[model samples]
Target chain A: MVNLGSIWQNLLASQAPLQSMTGNATTMAGLATYSLPQLPYAYNALEPYISAQIMELHHSKHHQTYVTNLNNALKVHVAAIASSDIPAQIAQQPAIKFNGGGHINHSLFWKNLAPAETPETNYSKAAPSLAAEIEKTWGSFDEFKKAFSAALLGIQGSGWGWLVKESTAEKGRLRIITTKDQDPVVGGEVPVFGVDMWEHAYYLQYLNGKAAYVENIWKVINWKTAEERFQGSREDAFADLKALL
Target chain B: MERDISDSRNQSANSLTLSLSLDKQAVTMSASLFRATPVARSALRAASAVKPAATFVRGKATLPDLQYDYGALEPYISSKIMELHHSKHHQTYVNGLNSALTTIAEAESKGDFTKAASVAPLLNFHGGGHLNHTLFWENLAPASREGGGSPDGALGKAITTEFGSFESFVKQMNAALAGIQGSGWAWLAKDKAANGKLALITRANQDPVTGNYVPLLGIDAWEHAYYLQYENRKAEYFEAIWNVINWKTVAKRFEA
Candidate 1:
């Protein structure tokens, strides 16, 4: 049965959305939220490879919109509960979930990207530790990129690219792999490197031209961030497999 | 059971959920490896790792090996069905494939399309047979693991993007297969048109849905595959077979 006292209060309300900006732990009664995150890098920095117009639209319009919808959904979610319309509340979950996640992922995405202005650090040489790992196992970095890119470009449609770690039967060593869509290798493979190939990701700047964007993104790739991801991925992957041994 | 973690590859039960994170605080990067015994491993390794020796069967192909045992497909497929299908039906295709290939090679060497044109049907039948059987084994799982349901991860995402939901994909495949009146197989080919990688496609019959698609997942909708057990119940077989789907293999293929 409906426990009007406890269930209504709890069900009518939702947990706070996880946003780093709200530094304080205090809650705002019904539900607290954060606003759209401004881009750390200027609009025009990416240039011809990625235009300022695209960046402005992508960050300001696309991303900010996700934030707006997320907040709007939460508000409706609260009203639906207060009115006690279970169906209305139930139906709103997916929009809330998708927009909320979209907001979160895009926020992180903005921070990861920067303009291709000055010299950008890329995986000119895969980091030594990761490189040594790949060399010892897969033979050469070129071969690794070929195999990895094969999986990355293979994605059928709009989705995030992933670099997953997996163990081959012969080699107990960890190696990176690629996967399509929302699948993250179920948390085993931390995303050390990625490129969002979805049309919305680069359509404005690169248009239907995927090849150009992929080629250009390499120049602006933040390899150091990818390296950190690789480090974190290795720490968990090897030891986790050892348990089976 | 508590102290000793089991070998994941041989995991017979379906509760196995492949995750990248375990309590050990490790990054996950694994798919289920099914090779348990050295013998199974050796044969599989030979089959999988045999550097594309893929004997191009020119005409009607045949069943290769059960790997486990001829009786292995028992219960689901039955030894009676396998014996006849393998020894009789499949053997016929193998013999035919060899003949067509030899004939084609001779014609090509002699620069004669006239002879090869006549042999086109033979190549389609036999080549299609070989391709189908080669892919069949790769698609199936043992009885314990049968009943492979919808895919997850990147595989699931692709299927969803390409053809709505997983159930919808199955409906399309089933409809496409059912539309094949006489004899043929159903396939979910690895599509590469988008990113020059894997794409899912279905071929009608002895026609290998040619071009490029890594034959990652397949099903023998031909009556010969299940008429013995279900007898005109192809739909039932399709439903039952989903349980034994070697998702781990499919996942690995996608990852590869």
Candidate 2:
């Protein structure tokens, strides 16, 4: 019997969109060179929770460095190839990996947050479906937040805590996973949302207070964007499985 | 340039056909050359890409020379930390590895396989520690002039291709390194089996990246590496170390 599902997947994948510049590293490099993604809101947008100063430096200074470095590395890589020096070319992997990951992660981090609702509240404003999913997964929204915060603080050095959907599974399930340094996970699952735990993400105002940053970030989470990400993941789950298979 | 583009397009077409050939042939679905998600197609391309091995020579263990002064990586990694780490910590591993090797050689001469097996753990721990540190030192440069630069050439493209952008790669490395509990090392490794697929991996203690994975760079996550300068503030230490990374050495390793 012809596996129509597989055929559809192969056909779709071959013609699959660049996924735009949604911050996937591998795809970004292929579609020309990567550029720094602009923040959706102003630097002071997530004030009280995330400071304007932190946002400005993170976006302009740190993130820009990654973009600049990545371009430089690519140039060196091109020259290395031209010279036929394979070793020299491969040695540039770390620079590309580090800066590339930084760009990809920060690009997503900017969109993960938004200006908190007025009157200052501590509550989960996730979309209805996402709220329901969180409740189903952890019994309650607060429970999910608590677990997520704990995991975020438990990071020993620098890294990220993610709320990702395992799209390749038989069923799409949300899980909290952490990656060290600038490593980004793609291909296996679709990332619904991610938080950068690197000190640069919060060290300026939060100082050593990772717990505060983790707890407060919830106030500014872009629930609409998250819901969109969730919907996209669900649609792509089958395609992901086909690719993996 | 147009010719190169056409050549690459042809190469990609050939590879895609080869990939379909390897997959379960329930049906032959031929599609236009334009089809395929860039990321997903890259994964398929990886399956058929050339895998290169990083050559390493096993010889007498000795102290590796630092290209810059001990104080070179200062502020990020203090001179105190560098001096102690290299002279004391790494030296201990080198000595231990050499000693273990001597015992193993003696055992082999005596045909005492059991004796050789007994000291195998020591050899791996110390030998891996030695090798890992060797790569670690080479990967670092003085933040002053020599270090803290972006990657270039093939190394840069590999990072962009494998991880997306240099920043994304850094974020992954930082996150993975921070999450590592106890003493361990975080690696930016090239998977030779999957056509030099660059990936971030972590190994506890002194475990080496053996088998099909070749390590391009390693960040030491042990407290001793930064405790003197950053105290319990591991984040600061991790953040600062980036300012001193020797991307050139890393690039060279990748090209190798």
Candidate 3:
């Protein structure tokens, strides 16, 4: 079974970057998700963090494909579910749920995976404010990884690796969380971060080595973006935390 | 296997139980140092049946009003971050979901499966978006009115009983959340199925837990939630969010 220290050490591991997001169709205002979050570095920037070839396909083909499929999937959802026929309506769920979550989560996941070491970039060097927050919680960044990576490596199949907020009796401090399939965090569970470990997500990048992929996820992490998430949810996160013992 | 989209039309009731994360906080419950549990250990499941009437919020999911101001979560969350998450990303989900719904409505009205099949994915994408954002607002609170804090009384006692201590539970849960392989969710649910009536569970996709458990609290482990703050070190982000949990809400939820 997983122990506290081992988990703690892994949690203390390095940080992550941003995920890429693209979209289709337009809005009433007519935007195609124009500002889809981009990678902090070049496709090859992740190199050892994530192979270049894998990065290429992941960003261009895989993620982009999700966007395409997501658009296509919704088109299908329309025709099937509208039927008064029970059978036809029920059949459309897998596509709607799976592809839908894939599209949304992947877009965010891409924004989360940034390529570090981009010299001369203004947002490099994991935001100090965020690091301070990390330091306050886990004692040290290393300790956080020990806990985070241990969790990241324990996946079974096509699913995501997540870092979510926890609830306490006091609601004082939030804890990390992981969800299966497209399961969601409820009760004001602020989503600070997540990683996709589905084979399709990384089989191409690191082959069957999910561990390697999970570990390297830090090298190109986008702390600045995370800082924004933390700062965004801070009031609620701690407001709840302060309520707890 | 064909699944039921009937559930899709129904919106989960706004029964967000705020208070202690309770059973889930079994220690190392320290902030900024959360961990993930492997998805292999738990299957995605749903809360015990407390079925409510079907809710059909047609059109698009709208931007919800925050319980507090955008910057109310300062220190834990930044104003800039809040602005973007709610107004930008979350809104996108609402718009995208509505667009999908409209398309589906037209296709089905025309009795065209081929056309319906074409836009099916958007339903998931936008629907998931609508669902996630709605839940996000329900579980949070303003720091002043018993939102962020620690557990006490019954909530505290329960956490102590299950995970030994709050610290242990937190570590384990953090491990569980960090352990997720992809974008999904981690939760602290009360499993009424068993005698104890509570257990911590995690689900991978946008699939809601469909078993005998009820959600007390959930964390969005998707990167967008924290990539702006913690980067790849998800554990740190997990740990840091603790300072802003809005526990008063959690406690009241548990009592309900």
Candidate 4:
């Protein structure tokens, strides 16, 4: 498992202006900004399931805008804090939450998707433990898929559907949940995988056929990543952020 | 605009007293803050500048009454979809808008800019939703009444000039509606910045048409607007909605 906590700690430490002045090359010059993470595979890697057009726009345009906005919001937030302007600080919160969650969710989303027909796409083969856990919870993999798909369709507006692992006393327990807008899975829950239900995610290819989009998403789901997230700590699951830092 | 505000104030008078005090407190605070600190003046100016008109007065945004029955636009838009869209979806936006405005007012009164700023997106979203739906309800009439057919006079001439022909305008508007990336609206608006020329525009996620464009007609592109009746075949919904479009309302806005 990746020791992402140390990396995160180091990132926080590197944010100090002193660290930049001390010739710490690893620290970003001046304020550290969260940059967009590169996709694990080519843009067309998930083709037929998700079109090249959708992938290109979703990543290069939509996700990139979120990353850019998040960095800008963070910069403004830091300035607001320094000046002790409470309203300015509060004003920045929504943008921070929206763009930050967008970045985090998209980062997790890209990683949890693999090229169709890959070993990672085979749930039982790549994720026996997670498959077993899913079967235990929802009776079978097919049943779990049905339940998750239903949750996805049930969203009224812009949102995401997530498969999460409960933390603490319910560590191994799994749940399917939906979050409105760009809300991330919070409260110590580990997001095993998330399927973005935002129209931009599928609209270019599927048009209005959301059900078909949900059905085909399973074709590209990376069970290897699911199993890894299920078995490891939350830190391990979010180690993708290290690249952005 | 003054008449509309007065009418809305009269309609919401019973519920206005509590919130009116809150608004007065907020206005008073901003005025005092304008004098007290130079640093806060810019923030307050920013806050007021982007603040929606609905937040200024009249307590809360109440759901407007439909002139016709929910089933009035039947055969085109189902009664079921109309009911849910107006009552459930639009009501949610109204409640959210009110709550966000109240939060902002209270926060500003206490000099908690953080709290006021935090609710800004909610203000934009719900306020836009309320205003859009209110306009949308008026933009439709029972087909037997003023709905359907083609616009006449200046609005008709403007549409022809902007989009070639009435048929072409309808085709282009439907295309615009279909091409929307997410939950949003496609609008036929008057561009105040360009000498009231007609324009076609789309807003993502309940963003009100503001700053130069006056939305004359808007077609919601959200799945909920059509999913119950049309399902995934939203092209059908887009086509059918025109049969119920109140060209009179569009013309009124255009002429205004």
Question: What is the C-alpha lDDT profile of model 3 across A92-202, one tens digit per residue?
Answer: 444434444554455556656666564211233555665665666788888877777876664432456655544342322435555555433333545556776654555
**Native-referenced Cα lDDT, model 2:** 0.65
Model 2 regions lying over 4 Å from their true place:
A1-31, A81-84, A118-126, A234-245, B1-256
Clashing pairs in 4: A86-B114, A87-B113, A87-B114, A90-B114
- CA displacement after TM-score superposition, residue B60 of candidate 3 (Å): 4.1
Q: Write the per-residue lDDT of candidate 4 for residues B1-256, one digit (tens) a residue.
A: 2233333333323322323223332444222211222233445566654443333432445677788899999989989778878887788887887787667665754568798878767777776787778778888998989889999999999999999999999999999997664478999988877999999999888877777677789999887787667755679999999889999878877876
The order of the candidates by DockQ, greatest first, is 4, 3, 2, 1
**Please, what are the lDDT tens digits per residue for candidate 3 over residues B46-76?**
2133121121112224566677788887666
Give the interface RMSD of candidate 4: 7.9
lDDT of 1 by residue, A1-245 (tens): 11112221232233422221132212222555546776767887767667787677667865676667766776776666566566676666555655554554565455446555443354544355656666676688678766666655544333455554453333334545543322223333454556665445665455434667777765665555555555664444222222211
Best by DockQ: 4
Give Cα distance to truth, residue B218, candidate 2, Å.
17
User: Considering lDDT, where higher is better, how would the candidates rank from best to worst?
Assistant: 4, 2, 1, 3
lDDT per model vs. reference: 0.53, 0.65, 0.52, 0.75
| Model 2: lDDT of residue A189 | 65
* Fnat per model, in the order shown: 0.00, 0.00, 0.08, 0.10
TM-score of each: 0.38, 0.45, 0.43, 0.53
Q: After TM-score superposition, what is the CA distance of residue A38 in candidate 1 from its true location, in Å?
A: 2.8
lDDT of 2 by residue, B31-76 (tens): 2221222333333345445231111112345667666788887778
Highest TM-score: give the candidate number.
Answer: 4
